[model samples]
Structures are given as structure tokens and as C-alpha cells.
Target: MANRLQHETSPYLLQHADNPVDWYPWGEEALEAARTQDKPILLSIGYAACHWCHVMERESFENPDIAALMNQHFINIKVDREERPDLDTVYMAAAQMMTGQGGWPLTIFLMPDGKPFYAGTYFPPEDRSGMPGFPRVLLAVAEAYRNRRADLERAANDIQGHLTEHFRWSLPETAITPALLNEAASGLARQFDEANGGFGGAPKFPPPMALEFLLRYRLRTGSDTALRIVELTLERMARGGIHDQVGGGFHRYAVDATWLVPHFEKMLYDNALLARLYTLTYQATGHPFYAATALDTIEYVLREMTSPDGGFYSTQDADSEGEEGKFYVWTPEELEAVLGPEQAPIVARYYGVHPGGNFEGKSILHVPEAPESVAAAFDLTIDELVEIIGPAREKLYAARAQRVWPGRDEKILTDWNGLMLRALAQAAIALGRSDLRDAAVRNATFLHTHLYRDGRLLHSYKDGEAKITGYLADYASLIAGLLALYEATFDVRWIAWARDLTDRAIADFWDNEGGAFFDTSADDAPLVARPKDAFDSATPSGNSLMAESLLRLGLLLGEDDYRQRAMTVLERFAALAAKAPTGFGQLLCAADLALAEAHEIALVGDPQVPAMAEMLAVVQQPYLPHQVVALRHPDQDGEDEVIPLLAGRTARDGQPTAYVCRNYACRQPVTTAHDLAAELGMAVE
Candidate 1:
């Protein structure tokens, strides 16, 4: 029989609708069942894209015998992590605290009251490799709960106590300074893998957040080492198997230090952040490779992940059936067949396909030789060489596309959509692609119309339904994205929307007395407690990013209230930042911007003017997250002081000129890129 998940909107929940195990989607009904029956809840939390989630589902959830056992002793409840990040966050933290480790396919045994007593991840159907089998463990746990209820209760209480204690660490009162940032950079440098790039040992995830921090640090302090770290990491990641050379987007992470052997899942958030990074790198260095890579990633997202309504989907699964990377990895024989005998060897050599495979006797595409080396080997012009490789890759990609594609989680998450929208908007401004900007605007409009109600945003959208009250991250990320969109197009509508959202966010989520934001709204469906999200994990903390957004919006709108609220939030958490810099990268980025002297450039003329366009393009190139730019045309008269920094500084020079200012003090008008760059302490050429 189909479970309650059959009717759910979440792709992850729908994936398990056909499981033999009677699963209930996490809700009041499931909790009531557990309470009324006096049965413990078997809470299984995993996302649709997780590889092991598929494995565990096939191995255990599908088996009738295992299903029967689960049905008898537990009220099985399932959660899609993307849809309910609050639940994921709370339980994952608990599991990590208890087991000293955590990952998806999170299995927890919870009492009827919703407190977990036992937790684990990814147990096999049969005991093997020193791990207990799922069925055996389930029976053992059930027996213990029945016979040793007191012991189980005590364990639950103890874990709850630890959780409370962990959350009670007070923030310090020290103010952040340049020395603190430098010290953090030095610590990061010590852990950086100088040989291959990225930080620490194996299983190298692109710490794009860390790279962002380093890039900003280098800009602030002129730290060459910091720039070097970011450059090497990006270059290695681009060159290695972790990046899909033909397809354009990156895999989740390399399982090894050399950026080889990626885990093979492609996430929306990773691509979004990396695209922005590459765009910024291109701006700073004017590197064609960086710009090309950024374009490719954006293209990949547009082609594969975008919804009909224009919002990007969450992710593509890492596994097909029970095998990881089965959809992607290519055997040598398969490649030889695809290319034919004449071209097979040449193609193999160019893409690092050797007799002995680099990964599990299957080739993961990589560049064995540099483009220059490849061109020299073929005795061809660089352009001709590129032309040949391009056709070959197209042929391969076409062939690969014919195969069974990985399962895509089609749920539209507001937080992730915010990230994608920001990337698209920034790319539009940087690359001068009006089409991209239009697409971003369309997505933003879709979110506003469909996912918002009563002036509040919803967390997820699927099957024409928007559900769940917005969390702090959802509001913060969307507000940030809207601000980016506004800056990209100088659209006052977007700015006004962002301002309204910020006002709603502060009213609903702010803890005025505590001086921080709660993860969920005050009146939203209650959990065990009102959780305060402070740590920067895979995404920036809601409070930190929102704090930054509030400041930016304040500057853009000329609202002292917004700026003051931002300062209050930052001041409240300033103490915690002193103790932990690594976990607060986003917050630190905001702090750096807030502390630095920010410049605002306002261009007054026709938006279609060639000179004005060029000026805007130059400023857009370098990742100046702190600076705000506004375009005012005489055609659009009666606009408020949208460009607050250039409120009084108008067009003095006869030709198109940019008024540069610091803290409301205007310098003489500059008419050319050379003069503007010189004034801004940037290289003109």
C-alpha cells in the first residue's frame, strides 16, 4: 500500500511513496500516531539527492520482512531535508553531538514526546564490515526500549542536557579588527594544501565560502598568500575530475586530495557560489578561462536545473539505482566504442583516459595535458585545436545525454533560489547579458507571486503549492538576492521589495531582547524550542547574512533604522565571533564590509549610452560587495535619492562622468576609467 508520502509535494517524500515500509511524512498525524500507540518513532531524514539515501531505501525500506518489523515497533516518519531544514538542523546537531559524526540517511529512535534517544547513519541490511545490520539493530533497540524504558529515558534526558549546554555558550564582547582577520587567514594558510590547493586532507569539498573570505581578506590587506591560495584551489578544481570538463558544472567534492575522484552529486548551491567566484576572478584578472568557466556553469544550470516557472531546482542525485556515479563514469571500452578506433586513442590521451583507470576501472574525464601542450602535440593553431576538442566533447555529451539521467529533486527551495538568483543577476551585470538578467527578474517575480502570502514568504514550492512558513535563512537569502537583482538592473521595484521583506523579517524573526534572529518565526509551528541559528555551515547563518543585507539595504534606501538594526544584531553576536572565526566566514565578510570605508558611484545619463555602459561594466567586474552603484537617467524623472551616496554629487562634467564618494564626501567628477580606477586604488589597465 502507498504511504502518506504519496500525496506530498516534496520530491524526496514522493521518492519513498512506493516503499514497502509504511512511512508517514513528518506531521501532526505521525506524531499523534506515535503518542497514541505508545510506540517510538523511527525518524529517517535524508534528501532526494543523497546517494546513500537511495542505497538504504533499496536495501532495507523495500524489503517486506524489514518493513514488517519496522511497522510493528515504530511509527516510521520521513523528512525531506531540503523542505524542513529546521528539523534537519536540530537532529543533525544532536546526532553529531552523540556520535561525533553525522551524514544523510540519518536514522534516529525518538520517544513519543519527540526527543531522540539513539541516532546513526547508513546501516546496512546485514551486519558487515563491523557495522550492525539494520534489521538486527532495529530488533535490539525495540527490545531494549521495552525492557529498559528507564535507561532509554535517562539517555534521552542526558542528550537534551548536552544540547542545552552547547547552545548556552555566550558571545564575547571584543570588537573585530584587521589583526583578527589576518590571524584567521594565517590559521587557514597553515591548513591549506600547498601542493594541490584547498584545505586539509582527503574528501576535498570546495570551501567556496573560505575562498570568498580569503579573496576579501586579500583585497583588504593585500595578502598575496591569500590570493595565491584562492587562485591555486580554483585552478586545480577546474582542471581535475571534480569539474565536468564537457558538461560544465562541478561535482560535489573530490574524495582525494588531488581534486580527482569526486562523489558525483551536483548541488545547486555549490554551482551558484562557484559561478560568482569565477565571475569575480575573471573581473580581477581578466582571465578568459575564468570567465568561460563561469558562463559554462550558468549555462548548465539554465539547461538542466531551471523550472518551467524560472526558479532553479534543488539538486541532481549522486546515484542511479544502488550504484554511485553509475550514470556518469565511463569505462575505457565504452569510450573506445563511442569514439571509434581511429579517434579513440587521441581522445583518450587528451582526456587522461589510460589503460589503468583513474577511478574504479572507469574513466572520469580530465585534462591530461594543458591546452598549449595539446595544441603543440597536434601541430594546430590554438583556435583550431579548440574547435576540434569542442566538436569531440559535443559528441560525447550527446551520447551521455542519451543514457539514463540521474534523478532530479525538483523542489524549489526559497533559500537555494535566492542563491541562484543572486548568481544569475551578478553574471548578467558582469557578462553584459541582458537575457540572464531578465531570467533572474522573472524568477524573482515568480517567487513573489506564488511563494509569498500576507506579506510573508513560504519556504518551498512544488506541484503548484507553496508550503511551510519562511525561516530566517529563507528571508535573509531572498532579501540578499533581491538586493543583488536591484543593483544589477537598477530596478527600483526590486529594491522596494527587498526593503519590505527586510521589514517583515525584522518584525517576525528578530529577538529584540536577545539581539539575534530565530531560525523560524515566533508564531510558526512550534518545535522543541525556538532555535537560534548562529553557526555558518554549508550556507551562511541567517542572522549574519541578514545583518549584512540590512546594512546594504539601509545604505541603498537611506534608512537609518535599517542600518541601526543591523548594528544591533552584529553587536549582540560580536562576542561569539571572537572565539570562532572559521565557522563565521559570512558574518566576517559582512563585518569587514561594514568596517571598511565604502564607496558609492552614481552615473547620471542615458542608460543606453555607450560611455555609461562601459563605466558600469568596469565597476561590476571586480567583486565589490560593499560598494553600491545606481544609474539615473533624465527620462526616469522624479525618482527618490535611490543613489544615496551620490545624492548631491550630480553630473558636473559635460560628458558621461562618475561621481565617486566616501561617507557622503564627494570627490571631483571623473570622466574616464583611468581616473576612476586610480581614485578607487584599482589598476586601470
Candidate 2:
């Protein structure tokens, strides 16, 4: 029989709809069942794409005997972590605190009142690999709860106290200086793996936040080392197996230092931020490879991850069937069977596939060298070589598509959408594609219309239904995307919308007394306690990005209130900024801008004027996050300074002229693209 989860909108919940074990989607029904039956709740939290989550589901949730045991003693409840990050965040923090470790397939035993007594992650069905079995742990926990009630109660009490206290911390008012940013960059450089790229050691995740910091640091201080770190990391990630050469887009992370093997899951957040970083890198260096990678990643998202309704799906699973990488990794023999003998060796050599194997006796497709090198090896022209390889890749991709695909979490999260919208808008500008920019505008509109109401933003939307009060990330990221879209299109409506959203976020999420933003709103759903997330995780913290967005928007809109609020937020969290620089690099970048000189360009003329358009293009071309530009008609007022070149300008002018200025000091008028490019510090052909 189908369980209660059959009715849920989340794909992760529906995944277990037919499980023999009666599973309830996390809701009032599950909580009521636990309370009425006087049984503990077996809370299983995992996302759709998690590899081990599938493993545990197949090994234990599917077995009849284990299902009976779970059914008898517990009210089983399932949660899609992506759909309910608030629940995931609070419990994941609790699990990490108790065991000093955390990961997916999070298992917790909670009392009827919704407080967890026991928590763990990824238990095996049978005892093996130095880990206890799920069945054994389950029996023991149930026995302890029944016979040693006082002991269980004491443990729950102690854990609850710790969980409650973790969210309570006083902010220190320390001034952030340029010296601190320099110090933080130096600290990050020491941890960077110069040989292979990326920071720290094995299992290197894409540290987009740190990369963003390095880009800004290079812009601020002209540090070659900072620029090199950004370049090297991006190049290696593009060439490594961590990137899907055939499909476009990056995997979750590399399990080793060399970036040769990856965790195989592709996440929406990772692609969004990496696309933004790659786009910025291309803008800074004008590297074709960086631009190609950024474009390919966005194309991948549009092709596979986007829903018909325009919002993006959360992730694609890491595993299909019982084995990891089964869909993506292939053996040389398989290649030989698919391709003729003559083409097999060529394809294998081009993609780093060998007789022995590159990964567990199966090859993970990677770009071993430049396409020119491969063409040279094949004794063909570059175009011909591309033609041959393209078809072969399509054949493989098509064959793999026929296999049972990994589960997808179809939940559209507001925070991830914010990240994607920013990436798409930025890419659209850098790549000069209006269609992509339109897609970003469409998604942003969808969020604003469907996911927000009554001055509050909802966190998740699925099947045309939005629920859960917004988190700080949702508002911060969405507003950031809106700002980016505004800059890309020069649309004041987006700017106005972003400003309004920012105001609401400040009123609802900001801790006026504490000086940092709370993860959840004051009157939202109750948790163990209100959380103020300051650490930069897979995405940057909401507080950090919000501070950065406010500073940028304030400069653009000429609003002192926004700028002052940003400064205050940064000042309030400076201790966290100093103590854990890498974790707070985004905040440091914002602080650097707040404490430094910001350039603003206001051109009063027709945007259609060739010279005016040229100037705008130059300004947008070079990843200048610290600069703001506005295009206005000659008659418009309220700007700090108006350029004389554009002062008498009209659309009727055969050629547009421009004025470049800093702090109300105007430069001589320039009428040509070369002079405009020179003024914006961009190279012109």
C-alpha cells in the first residue's frame, strides 16, 4: 500500500510513496501520529540526489522485516532537505554538535514533542566498515527509550540545551579595514593548493565564495597572486573530471586532490555560482575558455535542470541503480562496443580513457588536452575532429539516457533561484545574449509573483504551490539577482523592486539589537531557536551577500540609508570576520568596498547613441563589481554629476559623446569608442 507521502508535492517525499514502511511526509499528520501513539518519530532527512540516501533506502526502507520493525515502534517521517532547509539546518547542526560530523541520510530519533534525543548520519543495513548496523542501533535505541526512560530524557535535555545555546551569541562592534582584507587573502593563499588548484586537501569542493573574494581582492589591491589563484582554480576545474566535458556543468566536488574523480552529483547552487565566477573571470581576462565554460554551464541548466514553468530543479542524482557513477563512467570495452575499433581508441585517448581505467576501472570523461592536440593526434582538421567527437558523445549520452535515471529533487528553492538568476543575468550581459537575460527576468518575476506575498517571501515552490516562510538566504540571494538584472538591462523597475525587497528583509530578518540577520523571521515557524547563520557554506551567508547587495544598490540608487545599514551589519559581525576569514570572505569583500573608494558613472544621453552604448559596454565588460553606471536622458536630474559629453546629447546625434568623472570631477568629453574604452580601462581593438 502507498504511504501518506504519496500526496506530497516534493519529489523526495514521493520517492518513498510506495515503500513497504509507512512513511509520512513531515507535517502535522506525522507529528500528531507520534503524539497520539506515544511513540518516537523516526525522522529521515535526505535530498533526492544523495547517493547514500538511495543506498539506505534500497537496503533498509525497502526490506519487509526492517519495515515492520520501523512501523511497529516509530512514526516514520521523511523530509526533503532542500524543500525544508530550516528543519534540515536546525537538526543538522544538532547532529554535528553531538557527533562532530554531519552528512546526508540524516537519521534522528525524536520525542513526540519534536525534540531529538538521538541523531546520526548514514548507517549501514548490516554492521560493516567500522560502523554499526541500522537494525542494531534501532533496537538498542527503542530498548533504551522504553527501559531507561530517565537516561534518554537526560540526554535529550542536555542536547536541547546545547542546540538552544548555539543560536545565542552577542555580536562585537569591530571596524573592518583594508588591512584585514589583505590579511584574509594571505591566509587563504596559504591554504590554496597551488599545484592542482582549489583550497585545502582531498574532497575539494568548489569554494565559489573564496574565489569571489579573490577576484575582488585582485581588483582592489592588484595582487597578482590573488588573480593567479582565481585563474588557476577555474582553469583546473574546467579541465578536470570534476567538469562534465561532454555535457557541460560541474560535479559536486573532487574526491581527490588532482580533480580526477568527482562525487558525480550536479547541484543547482554549484552551477549557478560557478557560472557567475567563470563569467567574471572571462570578463576580467577575456579568456575564451572561461567564457565557453560559463556559457556551457548555463546551457546545461536550461537543457536539463529547468522546469517547464521556468524555475530550476534543485539537483540531479549522484547515482542510478545500485552503483555510483554507473550512468556517467564507462569502460574502454564499452567504448569499443559503441564506437568502431578505429574510432574507439581515438575517443578513449581524447577523453583520458585507458585500457585499465581512470576511475575504478571505468573512465570518467575529461578533457585531457586542447582540442587542437586531439585533432593533431587524429590527423584531421579541428572542425572535423569536433564533428566526429560530437556525434560519439551524443551517442553515449543517448544510450545513458535510456537507463534508469537518478532521482531528481524537483523542488524550486528561492535561494538557489536567486543564485541562478544572478548568474543568468550576468552571463547574458557578458555573452551579449538578450534571450538569456529574458529568462532571468522571467524567473525573477515568477518568484516575486508566486513566492512572495504580504511583505514576506516564501522559501520553496513546487507544483504551483508555495510554502514555508522565507529564510535570510532567499531574500538575500533573490535581491542580489534582481540587482544584477537591473544592472544588465538598466531597468529602474528591477532596481525599485530590489530596493523594496531589501527594505522588507531588513525589517523582518535583521537583528537590530544583535546587528546580524536571523536565518528565519521573528514571527515565522518556531524551531529549537532562531539561527543567525554567518558561515559561508556552499553559497555565501545571507548576511554577507545582503551587506554586499545593499552597498552596491545604495551606490547605484544614491541612498545613504542602504550604505549605512550595510556598514553597520559588517561592523556587527567583524569578530567572526577576523576569526574565520575563509568562512566570511564574502563579508570581507563587502567591507572592503564599504571602506574604499567606489566609482560611479552617470551618462545623461540617449542609450541608443553609439558612443553612449560603447561606454556602457566597456563598463559592463570588465567584472568591475565596485563600479556603478547609469544612462539617463539629458533632462533627468538628481544625479551627483552629469557628463558634459552627453549633456546636450540626443538620439538624433549621429555619434554619442561621453563624460567620465569621479566624485563630481569631470574629464574632457570623448566622442569615440577608443577614448571611451580608455576611460573605462578596457582594451579596444
Candidate 3:
């Protein structure tokens, strides 16, 4: 029978609707019931895409005996972490404190007032591998709650105290400088997997933000080593099984350092950030491979992850057909059946498919042989080989489409869509692809029309419903996307919307006392703690993203407040970033922006004119991460007033012109692309 989770909007919650466990969605009623009945709360938090979450559910949550024990002793409340990150943040910290590690599905025992007394991750139905059984753990916790209430209460107090103390930051004695960037760059260089093209060992996650920082470092100092690290990592990732060679998007992460075996989940934010990273890499190196990879990744998202309303989906599950990687893995016979014998050897050779297989008796397609090697072996040029592989990949993709697919989480998250939004806009501008531009524009419009209501942004949308008050990540990331959209499409409305959102975010989420932004807005419902996460994880922290946007928006409009707030955030996190550079990737990039010579450009002309197109092309075509390009129509009003960079800018010699500025001081106006490129220290044909 369906539990109370039947009425929940979250897909993760709905997954457990028929569980034997009498689950209550986290809400006031559950808390009130717990308080009235004097029962401790059994809080289980996980996401739709988590593989172990499904494992635990199958092993324990489905057990009727375990359910009865849980229902008798505690008020069971299930939470979708993605849906309620605030609660997750507060509880996750406590979990990490109680246990030395943390991951989903996070299991915690809490008091009625929301203080967590015990915490753990997945537990088996029966004790195995030295892990305690769920039934035993439940009864033990319940018994302890009855007999040792004071001890549990003391432990809860201690955990909360540690949670409060862990996030506090002291202002660094020194301000941000080039030396800091140099140190951080050197630190990343040390940790870099020189052989494997990633950091550390097994379970290598893609550090797009760190790679982005390296790119910026290369741009700032012309450090070939920094550039090399970015290049090698991207190349290796592109050729690995983590990247679906046939399907075009990437999986969640590779479980092995070789990037061979993946966890198989595909997340929107991962693809989004990777698309932009590849696009930027293409711009930096003028490599056709990076450009093509970017296009392929974007194509995958559009084909499988986008909704009818144009908002991007959250995640595709790691498992399908009752087994992980079943849908994606292929056997030698299957490949031969799909492709004729003549092409099978060539395709298999290129993709490293052997009869023995790399992953659990099935081939996970990866490029062990370089295209040059494959081309030489096939007695063909690179172009000819690419042409053959293109159609062949399409056939494989189509064949794979017929199989049972991974379950997709259809909910749209504002921060994740924001990442995709910026990616789309950047790809469109870099590659001159109108399809990406159109998609980005459509997404921006959808966010505005459906998610943004009465001058406020909502966090998530699913099944024609938009709820949840906007978090800091939502406002900051969406604003970043809007700014990119403005640059890509030259629509001033995007800029206006971005600026308004920035101001709203500052008002709603800025921590005046802490000198950084909180993850949750103060206007939102209270949690055990108002989380102010600064270090980057799977996504950039809200504070880090806000600092980035604030720096960019500040330069574009000459806003002192924005600049000052950004500096404070940088200074606040400087000590921590100095300690662990890789974890603070986004913050380092923002700090680079703060220190780099500001390249702010103002163009006054008709955006559609050929002369303007030439000038804009010069501005768009390079790896300029620290640039702020603001375009204003010759006839537009109020833009000049709101945007100080546009004031007094005019066309030169009756032709569309560009005004290149450094630190808000302008050089002479230039009418041609060549001159504009020269002014900006760039070369153009």
C-alpha cells in the first residue's frame, strides 16, 4: 500500500510510496506527531539518482519486519535531499560529526525539536561485511532513546555545537594576491594525477571548476603547465568510458582512476559544467576535438534530459532493468549483430571492445586506440575515419535506444538549470550554433515565466508545479546564466533580469555578520542551522558563485557595493582556500577575477550590423575569462543610466565601434574588428 509519500511531489519520495515502511514526508504534521507521541524521529534522506539509496531501500525499507519495528518506536520521515538541501546540510554535518563519513541514503535519529542524536549511511537488512543490521540498529537506537535519553541529548548538543563551530571562518590576515593564485596553482599541480589525468586515486570525479580555475590561471600568467593539466584531463575524460562514446554525454563519475568503470548515473549539472568547460577549452586551444565534444554533450542533454517546457531534467538514474549499466554496456556478439562483420572489427578496435570485456563481462565503450592510430590501421585519413565513425555512432545510439532506459528524475532545479543555461549560452556564442542559443533563450524564458513569480524565483519545478523558496545557489547561478545569455544573444532584458536578481539575492541571503552569502535565504523557513557552505563540491557553493557573479556584474555596471561584497567573500575564504586549493576551485577563479586587470568592453551600435558583428566576433573569439562585454543599441535608453560602462560610448566615423576599457578607463574608440582586437590585446584575421 502507498504510504503518505503518495502525496509528495518529489520523485525520490514517490519511489517509496509502496514501501512496507509507513513513511511520512518531512513536514509539520510528522514533527507534531512525533512531539505529541514522544517518539524519536527516524529521518532518511536520499536522492532519486543515488545507487546505494535504492540498494538500502530494497534491502531494508521493503522488509515488513523492519518496518514494524520502525513504526512502533519512531516517527519515520523521508526526505529527498535535492528537494530540501537546507535540511540535508544541517543533518549531513551532524552525520559527518557523529560518524567519520557521510553519504546518501543518510540515516539519522532526531529529537522532536530537530536535533539529531545518531546518524549513519546505508545499513543491511542483516549484519554483513562488519556492518550492523538495520533491524538491530533500529532496536538498539530505540532502546537507547528510552534508557539513555540524557546521553543521546548530550550527544546531539555536542554534534550541533561542532556543526556551528566547523563552518565559522576567520578573516585572513593577508588580502588576495597573485602569490595566492601561484600557490593554489602549484598545489593543484602537485595533486594532479600525472599518469591518469585526474587528482588522487579511485572514484575520480570530474573537477570542472578546478579545471576552469587552471584555465584562468593559464590565461592570467601564460603558465603552460596549467594549460597542460587542463588539456590532458579533458582529453582523457573524452576518451574514457565515463563519456558515453556513442550517446555523447558523461556518466556521474568514474569509479576507477582510468575512467573505465563508471557509476552510470548522468546528472544535468555535470553535463552542463562539462559542456562549458569543453567549449572554453576549444576557445583556448582552437581544437576541433573539444568543440565537437562540447556539441555532442549538449546534444545529449537536449535529446534525453530536456522537458517539453524546455527546463532541463535533474538526473538519470545509475541503474536500469534491475541492474546497473545494463542499458549502456554491450557484448561482443551484440555489437556484431548491430553492425555487420566488416565494420564490427573496426568499431570494436577503435572502442577497445574485447571478448573478455572491461566491465563485468560486458564492454563499456572507450577509446583505447587514438583516432590517428585507428585511421592509419584502416588505411584512411582522419577526416574519412571521422565520417565513418559518425554514422556508426548514430547506429549504435539508435540500437541502444531500443533497450530499457535509466529512470530519469524529471524535476527541474534552478541552480542546475542555471549551470546548463550558462553552458548553452557559451556554446552558442563560441560555436555560433543557433540551436543552442534558441534552447538557452527558451529555457531563460521558461524560468522567467514559470519559476520567477512576483519578482521572486522558486527553486524547483515538476509536473506543472513550482514551489520552494529560492535558495542562494538558485539566485546566484540563475543570474550567472542570465549574464551569459545577455552576452550570447545581446538581449538587454537578460541583463536587466540578472541585475535585479543579484540585488534581490543580496537583500535576501547576504550574511552581513559573516561577510558572505548563506545557502538558504533568511526569509525562508528556519532549519537547525542557516547553512553557509563556501567550499565547492559537486556544484559551486552559493557564496562562491555569488562572489563570481558579483565581480562580473560589478565590473559591467560599476557597482561599488557589488565589488566590495565580493572582496569580503574572497578575504573570508582566503585562509581555507590556501589550505586546500582543489576544494575551493570556484572561489579561486573568483579571486583571480578580483586580481586580474578588468577587461570591460562597451560597444555602442546596432547589434545586427555587419560592422558590429565583426567587432563582436573579435571580442567573443578568445579565452578571456576575465572579460565583461556589454553591448548597447545606439538608440536604447535607460541602459546607459543603469550601466555606467555604456555611458558616453558612441560609434566612431559613423560606423559601429567598440570601446575597450581597463579599470573603467577607456582607450580610443575603434570602428573595425582588427583595431578592437588590437586594443584588447588579441589578434584577428
Best by TM-score: 3
* Candidate 2: residue pairs that collide: none
Candidate 2 CA-lDDT value: 0.82
Write one digit per residue (lDDT tens) for candidate 1, span 1-685.
Answer: 7888999998888889999889999889999999999999999999988888988998999999999999999999999988998888778878998799999999999988888789999999999999999999899989988999899999888877776555543555456567666766777788899999998889888877677778888888888998999899999899888888878898888999999888888999889888988887776667888888888899999999999889889999887755678777776677777777755666677788876678777788888568777777767677877777787788888888988888898888899889888888988888888998998999899899888899999999988999999999999989989888987787777877887888899899887766678888988877654677777767788988898898787666677787777777676665555346557777777777777788766667666778776677667767776687766665665445444554554555556778776655668888776777777778767
Q: Which stretches of candidate 1 lie over 4 Å from their true place?
A: 568-582, 641-657, 668-675, 682-685
lDDT tens string, model 2, 1-685?
9988888888888888999999988878888898899898899999888888888999999988889989988999999888877788888888898788999999989887788788899988899999999898889888987898788778877887887777655655878787777778888899899998999889889888888888888888899999999999898899889998777888999999878799989999999999999999999888888998999899989988898878988998888776777778878888888887988877888888887778777889887788888889889898888788889988777767777876677889999999999999999888888889889988888888889888788988888889888889999999999878976776666776787888889888887766768888888857665677777888888989999998887766666788888888888776677667778877877887787667666555656667667777777777887776666565455332322222433333545566665543556656676887787676677
Question: How does residue 566 of candidate 1 score in lDDT?
Answer: 75
Clashes of 3: 0
Number of the top candidate by lDDT?
Answer: 3
Q: Which pairs of residues collide in candidate 3?
A: none
Count of backbone collisions within predicted model 2: 0
TM-scores for candidates 1 onward, in order: 0.95, 0.92, 0.98
> For candidate 3, lDDT tens digit of each residue in 34-60?
999999999999999999999999988
RMSD of each: 2.2, 3.4, 1.3
Model 2 spans > 4 angstroms off: 336-339, 369-403, 633-685
